[model samples]
Target: MTERIAREPGRSTFIQRTRRAQLIACAIDVLAEDGYVQASLSRIAKRAGVSRGVILYHFSGRDDLLDAVVSEVYRIATEELRPTIETQSTALRAVRTFIVGSAEFYRAYPAHMAALREIVAHSRSADGTIRHSEHSRANERELSALGVLFERGKEAGEFRAFSTPIMARTIRSTLDGLLGQMRVDPGYDPVPEAHEVADIFERAMMRQSE
Candidate 1:
């Protein structure tokens, strides 16, 4: 399949796309098993059981492939969680649903989360600085969306007095931390942790007695 991607332009576009997708899936596995820097094109190709030329044909370089990896992971995660978020009737429920959904998403797609974490931890620029700012904002966008939901909750008297920025950051940080921990600790379970996190935010977001 890798050899197919390097075929002439006359090849069907669909075949090229399939080869790229296969390479990307292999890259993801390499990233999760090895750290970011170690997930070189050769390593990814080997994982895909294809020649090195196959990966180079599809991706420009390490950075480009990492970008593709991050893009795919974010796409899959968002698609998985959005429907769960939409199922809730109110902002509070949305918040809980998002958290619980995230936990379930991680459990179901551990490799996706693992690959994403590796990319963030090791993605760098030619100047030796982190190049993850681009995708980091995508993750932050989810928090911002939650912030907007919280603001709506406040307006509707569903939430208590609090700064949305801080609240959103705290919640995002907690969930992110949980994911990190789950990666390192095999014994950790996200289900109960999801409930605990939801309960914490639920209490913090509730209006106090008049």
Candidate 2:
């Protein structure tokens, strides 16, 4: 297969796209089941029932393939959450929906959530720096968006005076922790935990009756 692809570099676009998607899916499965340290290109290729050359044909290298895995997972999550979050009547509803929707998304896509966490925890950049050290661009973007929601709630008098950045970070941290909990405890139910979190935040942020 690799030889064929190499010889006919101008393969049909549909075939190329399908192969890339298959490789990415295999990578995610391997990452979720085997952890980041063990999810080598060869492992992914074996899982995909293809040669390593097939992966190289589609992606530059392991990092490039992992990047695609992350991008694809996030793309799916965003599409899943957008409708629920966007249709809310108020900022508070949006915030709650975001929280619950995110948990539901994790539950629905456990493998994806696990693969993403593994990638974020282990993937490094040039110069041996952690890609998600302190806070990666992806984290910053999520925090910034959450901060906007908090600010909107405050401006509308649905929430109390508080630091939006701090609250955003707090929520993000809690959600990340929830993923960790689910990984370790088979009995753990994130939906209930998510509801608790949503309730806590709603109460904490609600405006005091004047």
Candidate 3:
């Protein structure tokens, strides 16, 4: 298996990477349209206009392909949001931008977001354990980033003193909750809700006014 999966005898790394990216893109679409249970390797291959061997050549199996899908979605989202988040001078502003930025990201890459949610919800290993638990890294990073923002706000006297862990988790949960709601009710508009959530947090985090 390793030999079959190794770098093609003469294929440049760039070509290999491009092929893998294309396969992942196809996988994302299939998973989004069909859900994890229904997204067969052949289905993804048919969508990509490739043979099943092509997908197997790029990925070890379904697990590997799904993992790549989750990783790519996170990579894309971070690429979209990080620059804007860096622009905010105040920690509170960063939090607001983070939520609003996420809404923008969802709007821009609805397929990626939907595919990720589906894979996370249904992908399972042979042992029946959740297959793609690696997303915890992204979750942890968000919590830590939010923690940093809270600390900065505290230092600047912009935010009230509070348990940063709880506050960070609360904020993260609120944003994720909006997405979950949208999955159930398509009528949910996240951008406005993001703004409202940001307002609620800003007030909660801000120092009590004189």
| Tens-digit lDDT track of model 1 for 1-210 | 644445433454877778877887988898888878798888988898989876777776677778878878878888988887877889899999888888888888888788898887776678897786657768778878898889989999999889999998898889888888988896677878898999998999999888
Q: What is candidate 2's lDDT per residue for 45-146, written digit by digit as tens?
A: 999999998788777678778878887787788899988888898999999998999999999998898899898878676678775432265577778878
Model 2 residue runs over 4 Å out of place are 1-12, 124-128, 132-135
lDDT against the true structure, each candidate? 0.82, 0.84, 0.83
Q: Specify the poorest-scoring 10-residue window by lDDT in model 3.
A: 3-12
**Candidate topping lDDT:** 2
**What TM-score does candidate 1 reach?**
0.87
TM per prediction: 0.87, 0.87, 0.88
Q: Which stretches of candidate 3 lie over 4 Å from their true place?
A: 1-12, 123-128
Best of the candidates, TM-score: 3
Error of 1 at 50 (Å): 2.2
Q: What's the candidate order when arranged by decreasing TM-score?
A: 3, 2, 1
On a 0 to 100 scale, what is the lDDT of residue 198 in model 2? 97
Q: Quick one: how many clashes does candidate 3 have? A: 0
> In model 1, what lDDT does residue 179 have?
89
